[model samples]
Target chain A: MQTIQTIIGYLYYAIAAVIGIVIVANFVRSRDVRKMLLYAIVLSPFVLRVLRVK
Target chain B: MADSKGNSLVIKIVVVALWLALIIPGGRQLAAHRNYEEAVVLGPGVTEVKKLSDWAPYVANTPNDCSIYVLDSGVPGGSMLVIGGTHPEEPAGVLSAVTIVENVVPTTGKIYVAVRANRSASTVTRPGDAYPQFFNINTDFGKRTFRMGDRWSNPLDSWPDPEVYVHYPSKQLLAYMDVRNLNRTWPGRPDGMITERTTRAFIDMIKAENIDIFVDNHEAELEYSVISTIVAHQAAADVAAMASMMLSAGEFNMGMEFSPTLLHGLSHREVGDHTDAYAFEIEVPEPFLDRVRGITDEALLLEGKDEFVMRAGQAGLLYEKIDENGWNIHERVGRTNSTIDMIVQMFAMFYPDKPITYESLPMRNDIVANGLGHYLLDPAQAEADRVVYE
Candidate 1:
C-alpha cells in the first residue's frame, strides 16, 4: 500500500512537470505575439508554483 | 505539428488533474480549521460569568447571544463595560478584551467584558476575499485558535436586506446591508432585526447593571479619515479629551473627536444619547481592511504587512502611515489596552464619585515586549466551572 501510494505521488509529479515544460515550450515557439503573451500569462502560476521557496 | 493536438489534449488533462490535486488539499485544510473556538481562562479577578440573555432574555438560545465576563471588586465604586468583536474582522479589539478578561485584577470597581459582542459575526468569514477561517495565537499551553470573522452579522443568521436601511428612532437612511452591522445598530430596538436586538440586549444590560462608562472596541481601515482616533459622544467629550491627552503623553499618539450628532446608528452617538452611561469608541488602524491591501491572508491579518497598502500610503491615499514593520497585532492591541486604561483613569478622575480601578493588566510596553499570547491564559487548565465560551 505504501509503495503504491509513493508510485502514485511520483507519477502525479512527473505528469505535472512534463505538462509545465510543454506549456513553456509552446509559449516560446508561438509566432503570434498575442498568443505567446496569453500562453505566458497562463503558465505564470505554474512557474510561480515551481519557483516558490516557502 | 501533427502530434501537437494529441499532446495538447494530454497536457490539458494533466493540468486539470494538478489543479484538482492542489485545490482538494487546500479546501480540506480550510474546512477543517473553519470553526475555530478560543478559550477564555477566567483569572483570579473574574467573579462570575453570565450570558447576554441573562441581562435581556430576548436573545436567549440565539447565535447572537454572547458571554459577559464580570470582574467585580468587592469594594465597588463604579462599573464599566468593554465591548469587543462588534465587528469580528477587527480582531485586535476582541483579543484585547480577552486579554483583560483573562489577566486584569480589579481592585476598586467592576469591569464587564463582552469578548464576542457580535457572536453571530464570528461564525462567518468575508466572502470572495480568501480570508483565512482561523488565526492562531501562540500561548504557553499551545496555539490558541480564533475565528476570523466578518464585519457584519452572518447572512445565515440575518438576510433579505431592505432596499434602504433607515436608522430606527432617528429615521436616517443608511446603506441597505448595514442593517446587519452591529456597530450601526446601536441603542437598538427590542423587536427589530437580529443586530438591533443584540444591541438592545446590551443596552438593557447597561441600564440594569448601571454601567458608568461604555467602551466600544473597533479597528478602522487606514483609508478611513477616522483611523487611529477616539470618537466620543458629546456627554463624554471631557473624559475623551483628558484620556487622549494623557495617552499621547504616556504612549502612542491618539486624538479625540466628537461623534457626529447626525450619525444615528453608531454606538458613540446613540449609546450616550439614549443612556446615562458615557460612550467612547476607539479606532485602531488596520491595513488589512484597506482597499489597497494585497493578498488578504492570516499573515497579513496578524502581522498587518501589505506592500500595496504601503504603496498607497506613499501616494498620500492613507489616513495612517504604513511601512515594512506594518501595524502589527501586538501594536494595535497594545494601543487599545493602553487607551482603555487611560480612558478609565480619566473617567475615575472626572467622576470621582464613580471610580473604576484595576491592576495586573499587561501595559502597552509589556504587551509589545512579551506579545499578546503572553497575557492570555489557557482555559483547558482552568477550573471546569470557570471556562466559558463566547
Candidate 2:
C-alpha cells in the first residue's frame, strides 16, 4: 500500500508539472488563449477530484 | 476542435481538484493547531490567582473571562498592573506577561499580571491570513504550545459588528469592527459589549486595587512608525522619558512618544484620564506582522525571519530594521521585559513614596542569551494549585 501510494504521488507530480509547462508555453505563445489555458489548468484537478474521475 | 474543447474541460476539472485537495487539508491543519494551550506556572511571587469575573461579575461564564495573577511583596510600597494579550495576535505581549508571572519575585511592591487580557481573541486565528493555529517554544522539560491568536475577538463570541461603533462616555465614533478590539474599548462599560466590559473590569480592578502604574504590552508591524517605543499618557511622560533614556543608554534602543490625546478608547489615554494611575503602553517591532511577510507560519512567528519583510526593510520602507536574523521572539519579548523594568525603576525614582520593585525578571541581555523559554517554568512540574491555563 505504501509503495502504491508513493507511485501515485510521483505520477500526480509528473502530471501536474506537464500541465504547468503546457500552460506556460501557451501563455508565451498566444496572449488571448493563455488565460483560458491557465484557468483550465488551475481548475482541472478540482473538477476531476469532485467528479471522482481519478 | 471538439477534442481540444473536451481536453480543456478535463484539465480545468483536474486543476480544480488539486487546488481543493491542498486547500481543504491545509485549512484543517491550521484550524487544528489554533486550539493550542499554554500553561501558566504560578511562580514563587504569585500570592493569589483570581478570575477577571471576580472584579466584574457580568463577564462570568463567558469566553472573555480571563485569569489575573497577583504577585504581592509582603512589604508593599506600590501596586502596578501589567496587561498582555490586548491584541492576541501580538504574542510578545502575552509571552512577556507570562514570563513575569513565571519568574518575577517582587521584593518591594505588588504586581498584577494578566497574561490574556482578551481571552476570546486568543482562542481564534486570523481568517485568510494563513496564520498558524499554534506555535511552540522548546524548554527544559518539554515544548510549550501557544495558540496563534487573532487581532479581534472571535465573531463567534461577539457577533454582528455595529454599523458604527460609538465609544462609551466619549461617544466617539470608531470603525464598526473596533467594537471587538479590547484596546479601543478602554474604561469599559459594565452593560456594554464583552470587550468593553472586560476593559471596564480592568478599570475596576485598577481603581479597587489602587494601582499606581498600568502598563499595556504590545508589538507593532515594522511598517508602523511607533515600533520599539513607549507611548505614554500626559501624566506619565516624565517617567516614560526617564525610562526611555535609561533603556537607550543601558540596554536596547527605545524611544518615548506621547499617546495621542484625541485617540479615544486606547488604554494609555483613557486609563490615565479616567483613573488615578499613570498609564503607558510599550510597543516592540515584530516583522511577522508586516504586510510583505513571506510565509505566515510558526517558524516566521517564532524566528521572525521573512525574505519579503527583509526586502521591504532594504528598500527603506520599514520603520524598523529587519535582516536575516529578523526580529526573533526572544528579542521582542526581551525589549518589552526590559522596558517594563526600566519604567518601574524610573517610577520608583520619580515618586519615592510609590516605589514598585521587582527582581528575578531576565533582562534584555539575559533573555537574548538564555532565550524567553529559559525563564518559563514547566507547569507540569509545578504544584497543581500553582498551575493555571491561559
Real contacts recovered, all predictions: 0.00, 0.03
Provide backbone clash counts, one per model.
0, 20
Over the full model, what C-alpha lDDT does candidate 1 score relative to the true structure?
0.83
B201-311 per-residue lDDT for model 2 (tens digits):
999889989999999999999999998999999999999999999998988789999989888999999999999999999999887799988888888888899999989
Chain A TM-scores in order:
0.67, 0.58
The runs of at least 3 residues in candidate 1 whose Cα sits more than 4 Å from the true structure, single-residue gaps closed, are A1-54, B1-35
Docking class of 2: incorrect
DockQ, in order, for the candidates?
Answer: 0.02, 0.03
Q: How accurate is chain B of model 2, given as a TM-score from 0 to 1?
A: 0.92
lDDT agreement with native, every candidate: 0.83, 0.84
Best by DockQ: 2
Clashing pairs in 1: none
